[model samples]
Target chain A: MNLKIALLGGDGVGPEVLAQAVKCLQSVEVTFNHHFTFSPALVGATAIDQTGNPLPDETLEICKNSNAVLFGAIGDPKYDNDPIAKVRPEQGLLKLRKELGLFSNIRPVRVYPSLIDRSPLKKEIISGVDFTIYRELTGGIYFGEKKLNEKGTVASDLCEYSEKEISRMAHLAFKAAKNRRKKVTLIDKANVLETSRLWRKVVTRIGESYPEIELDFLFVDNAAMQMILNPAQFDVILTNNMFGDIISDEASVITGSIGLLASASVGTDFAMFEPIHGSYPQATGLDIANPIAAILSAAMLIEHHGLNEEAQAIYMAVENAIINNVVTSDLNPDSRFGTDYVGNYIANSIVDTD
Target chain B: MNLKIALLGGDGVGPEVLAQAVKCLQSVEVTFNHHFTFSPALVGATAIDQTGNPLPDETLEICKNSNAVLFGAIGDPKYDNDPIAKVRPEQGLLKLRKELGLFSNIRPVRVYPSLIDRSPLKKEIISGVDFTIYRELTGGIYFGEKKLNEKGTVASDLCEYSEKEISRMAHLAFKAAKNRRKKVTLIDKANVLETSRLWRKVVTRIGESYPEIELDFLFVDNAAMQMILNPAQFDVILTNNMFGDIISDEASVITGSIGLLASASVGTDFAMFEPIHGSYPQATGLDIANPIAAILSAAMLIEHHGLNEEAQAIYMAVENAIINNVVTSDLNPDSRFGTDYVGNYIANSIVDTD
Candidate 1:
C-alpha cells in the first residue's frame, strides 16, 4: 500500500523531535513492505519567517492532497509576548484545522505501568486508567464571533452550537464506546448554560440509537474533580471545545507522562496526528528533548489508517524502549541516549522485530 | 458586640449539617462574650414547597436586614431530574447573589497536615498547598444573554466582561496577596479568546499599580494541569466566573478533603458564607453527614465580620477535632461520631480553650 504523508514541522524543537518520528515511520515502511511518500511543508514561525504566512496556501494544498498529516509543534516566544499581534503561530494551526474541515480532536490518555510512579496520583488510583477524550474542535467559543467595544472597556465572545454539530461528535463517541468500554460520559455546564441544554438534548437523542452503550452526564466542575478522584471510572469523555481544551490538558498531567501522550484531529476525509507536548524551544538544538511522544503520534497515524499490525509494531517498540531504558533525560535523567540515539533505537527495534 | 445572623438551611442535608454550624457559632458567641441573634428563613426546595417560590421576598427581606448570612447547601434530586423546570433550587442562590449584589466568590484550598494522606496526590505535592481563588461571581457567561434561534436548533450564550469587572476582582486579589504570599496568577485563555486578551490588558495594568506583588499569567488549560502537578505554587488565583468555577473545584479535590472546604460570596454591602459541598438529598435525614465544611464556613463568616480572634478560635477547635479523630464518617469510617457529635465536640473544644 502507498500512503502520502505531509510533514509540518513547525517551530523550535518541532523539527528536531519530528525528525525522530519520520525515522520511525521509515522503519515501519521497511518492515511492513509499504510505500509512504513524505511531503515537507512550512508552518508556524518557520513559515512566517520564510513566506510571511504562518500557514501558507501551498502547505494547505499539500495537506489536502495527502492521506494523512503528521504535525510537529507550533509557536515561538516572540509571538507569545506580543499579545496584540495580528498574526501568530497558533492561528496557523487553527486556520489549517478550519481549512481542512477537521472538527473533532481525539486524545488518548493511558497510564503506562512503568511510568505510574511518576504520576502525582497514587498508583492504586491511576493504575488501570486508560481513556480517550473526544473533543468538538470547530464549533464552540473558540470559533465564535468576538468583539470589543469602541472604548475597549467591554469584550465579549459568543458560545454557540447546533444539533448537527453536536450529533456528529456524539455519534463518533457512541460508536467508539461500542468498541471499547461501552460507556460515554458527556461533560457540560448544563445546569447554567443554554448551549449545554442543547448538547444534552442532542447527545441523548443520538445516544438512544446506541442502546448497548451506557450514557451519563456530569457538570464540568464535577467532571474536573472526578478526573482526579476516580479517573478509572471514565471510558470515553465527550465535551465542547473549551471544556475539552481544559479537561483534556488536566487529564494529560494526571498520567504523569507528558512525553508519551499523542493526539489526533480528525475530519471526514482528513486526519492529523501529533504529540501532545509543545515544542521545547530551549532544547531545540540540545538533543535532550523526548521524542517518544512524536514516535507514538506516528503510531496513531498508522492506527488511524487501519494498519493494525504496523501500529502494534510501533507500540511494541515504544514499550521495549521504556523497558530497556533508552529514553531522553525527561523520562530518565541518568540515561545516556540523546534524542537521535533514542529515535534510532526505536527505529531499529521496529526493523529487528519479526 | 451584637450581631444578627440569618440561617437559610435549605433542602436535604443542608439543615442537618447547618445545625452543626449553628452549635459552633453559638459557642463562639459564648466564648467571645458577643450578643448574637439567629433568624431562620425558607429557601431552595423547602422554600418551593412552602411558598411556591425558590427565593421568596420574605427570605430576601430577612437576609437584607441581617449583618451576615450563614447558608447551608441547596438543590434536590427532584429538581435535578427536571431539565425544563421553570424554577430551580439554585435559582434562589443566583437571585440572592444578584439581589444582594454579591459578585466576588472566595474559595480557599488548604491542605491540613493531618489530612495530607487523604489526598490523591503525593504528600510532597500537596503538603504545603494553600491558595485562595477569587472568582468573579455575578458576570461572565453564566449571566450573559442566552438565546435559542427561531427554529430552536441553534443555541448561543454570550460571555462578556468589562474592565470594571476585571479590575474590581483584581484589586481584591492583589490586596489579599499583599497580606499573604505577595503573588497573583491570572488564569485565562488569552491566545484563543478575545475577552481573555482584554482580561490580560486590564489585569496587567492593574498589576502595575502593585509594585510589590508578582503578577503572572497562565492559560486556563495549563492552569488546570498545574493545579494537580503543583498546587502549592499558587498563592492567589484570580479568574473570570466560568474558569473560576472549574479550576476552583479542581483545586478543592486536590486537597483530598472535600468534606472540609468552605466558601464565601461577597459584594459591596453584603456577604454569604456556605460549604462548597452541595445538599446531599440522599443523606438528608442521616446522621452520617460531615459538618466540618459547614462549621468552617461559620468560621469564615466570623472572619468576614472582622472577628479575627473569634475566627481563629473556631479554626483551632476544628483543627483539634481533626487531630483527636472526632470527625464524621467521610473523614474516618471507623470513628464513632455522628454529625451532631462532631459539631458538639468542636463547640466544646472552643469552650474549653483559653
Candidate 2:
C-alpha cells in the first residue's frame, strides 16, 4: 500500500524531530512491503521568513493533496518575547487547523508501566488509568471572534456555537465509547455559562441516538477535581475547546512522562497526527525527546489510513520496547541512548516479529 | 464586644461539622474577651420541606439580624436526583449570597506538611504551595440571563459583567495581596467571553491604582494548567464566578485534601463563612468527615471581625494539630481518633501554653 504524507516541519525543533520520524517511517517501509511519499512544506516562523506568510499557499496545497499530514512543533522565542507583535507562529498552526476542517482533536493519555513511580500520585492512584480525550478543536475560544475595544480598556471574544459544529464530534465520541468502556462523560459548565448550556443541550440531544453507551456529565469545576482525585473511572471523555485544552494537559501529567502521549486531529476525509509535546529548542540536535510519542503518532496515521495490522505492528513494537527498557533518555534518563536508537529499536521490533 | 452569629446547619453532616466549629469558637470567646451569640436557623432541604421555601422569610430575618453567618453545607441527595425541581436546596444558598450581597469568596489552598504526600502530584510539585483565591461570587454566569429558547434544540445562558461588578472585587483582591505576597494573578478567559473582557477591562483599570503590587493576567485555560504544574508561583489569584469555581477545586487537589480548605463569602458589611468541603451525606452520622476546614472558617471569621491575634492563635493550633498527628481519619486514618475527638483536641490546642 502507498501512503502519501504531507510533512509540515514548521520551526524550532520541528524540523529536527520530524526528520527522525520520517527516517523511522522509511526504515519501517523498507523492512515491510510498503511504499510511501513524504512531501515537506514550510510553515510557521520558517514560512514567514521565506515567504512572509506563516501558512503559505504552497504549504496548504501540499496538505490538501496528501492522504495525511504529519506536523512538527511550531513557535519561535523571538515572537514570544515581543508581546506587541501582530503575527505569531501559533497563528499559522491555528489557521491551518481551521482551514483544513480539523474540528476534533483526539489525544490519548496512557501510562507506561516502567515510569509509573515517576508520577506524583501514589502507585495505587495512577495505576490502571487509561483514557482518550476528544477535544472540540475549532469551535471554542481559539477561533472565537476576538476584538479589542477602541479605547483598549476592553477586549471581547464571542463564544458562540451552532448545533452542527458539535454534532460531528459527538458522533465520533459515542462510537469510541461504544468500542471502549461504553461510557462517555460530557464535561461542561451547564449550570453557569450560556455557551456551556448550549454544549450540554447539543451533546445530550445527540447522545440519545447512541443509547447503548452510558452518558454522564460533570461541571467543569468538579471534573477538574475528579481528574486528579480519581482518573481511573473515565474512558472516552469528551469536552469543548477550552476545557479540553486545560484538562488534557492536566491529565497528561497523570502519567509520569507527558512525552509519551500522541494526538490526532481528524475531519471527514483528512487527518493530521503529531506528538503532543512542545518545541523544546534546548533538546534540538540532542536526539532525546522520547520519540515513542512521535512513533505512536505514526502508528495512528497508519491506522487512520486503513492499515490496522500495520498500525498494531507499530503499537506493539513501541509497547514492547517500553516494557523491555528500550527507551530514550527522557523516559529513562540513565539509559544512554539517542532518539534515533530508540526509534530504530522500535522499528526493528515491528519488522522482526513478523 | 458581643456579636450575634446566625448558624445555619443546613443538611446531613452540616450540623455535625458546624457543631465542632462552634464549640471551638465558644472556647475561644471564653478564653479571650469576645462573646458570640449563636442563633440557630433551619434552611436547605429541611426548610424547603417545612416552609415550602429554602430561603424562608424567617431564616432570612434571622440572617438580617445577625452580624455574621456561619453556613455549613447545603443540598440534599433527595433534591439532587430530580432535575426538574424548581425550589431546591442550592437555591437557598444562592439566594442568600445574592440577597446579602456576598460578592467575594475568599478560598485558601494550603499544602499541609503532614499530608502533602497524599497529593496526586509529585511531592516537590506541591510542597510549600499556599495561595488564596478571590472569586467573584455573585456575578457572571450564576446570575447571567438564562433562557431556554422556543426551539428545544438550543439553550443559552448569558454571561455578562459590568465595570462595578469587577472593580470592587479587583480592589479587594489587591488589598488582600498587599497583606500577603504582593502579587495578584487575574484569571479570566478574556480571549473568549465578553463578560471576561468586561472583567479584564475594569480589573486592569482598578489594578492601576495598586502600582506597588505586581499584576499578571492568565487565560482561564492556562491558569488551570499552571495550578497543577506550578501552583507555588501564584500568590493571590482573582477570577470571575465560573473560572474560580473550576480553578479552586483544581487547586484543592494540589493541597491533597478538600477537607482541609475553608472559604469566606463577604459583602459590603455582611459575610458568610463555610468549609470548602461539600456536605458528605454518607459520612454524616459516621463521625468521620473532617472538621478542620469548618474550624478554620471560624478562624477566618474572627480575623474578619478584626480579632487578628485570636485568628493567629487558631491558625497555630490547627497547624500544631496537623503537625502532631492529632487529626481526623481523613488526614491520619490510623491516628486513633474520630472527628469529634479531633475537633476537641484542636479547641484544646487553641488555649496552648506555648
| Top candidate (DockQ) | 1
lDDT by residue for model 1 over A258-332, one digit each (tens)? Answer: 889999999989999999889778888899989989999999998888887888899899889998899898999
Specify the highest-TM-score model's number. Answer: 1
**What does candidate 2 score on TM?**
0.93
Residue A24, candidate 2: C-alpha displacement in angstroms: 3.1
lDDT against the true structure, each candidate: 0.92, 0.82
Write the residue-wise lDDT of candidate 2 on B1-354 in tens digits.
688899998887888888988988987898786789999998899789998899888888899899899988988898999988988999899889878989999998888878878887878889988889999888765666555556644444445566677888999899989888999999987666766777777877888899989998998877876776789899999998878888888888877788888899999979999997788888888888888888999889888888777888888888988999988887876867778988898888777343
lDDT of 1 by residue, B1-354 (tens): 788999999988999888999998899888889887899999998999888899999999999999989999899999989978888999899899999999999998899999999999999999898899999998999999999998879999999999999998999899889978999999999988988999999999999999999998999999999998989999999999999999998998998998899999988888999999999888888798999999999999988888878888989999999999999988998988999899899988885345
Please compute the TM-score of chain B alone for each predicted structure, in the order given.
0.95, 0.94
Ten-residue stretch with the least lDDT total in model 1 chain A:
A345-354
Alpha carbon deviation, residue A243, candidate 2 (Å): 1.4
- lDDT per residue as tens, model 2, A1-354: 898999987876677667767766786687667888999998988888888888998888999999999988888887789989788888889888878899999988877777788776667888888889999988765565555556554444445566777888899899888768889988988766776777777888889999899988988888898888888889988998878987887788777777778899999878899888887767767777667777788888887777767777888888888888888877776898787788778777776355
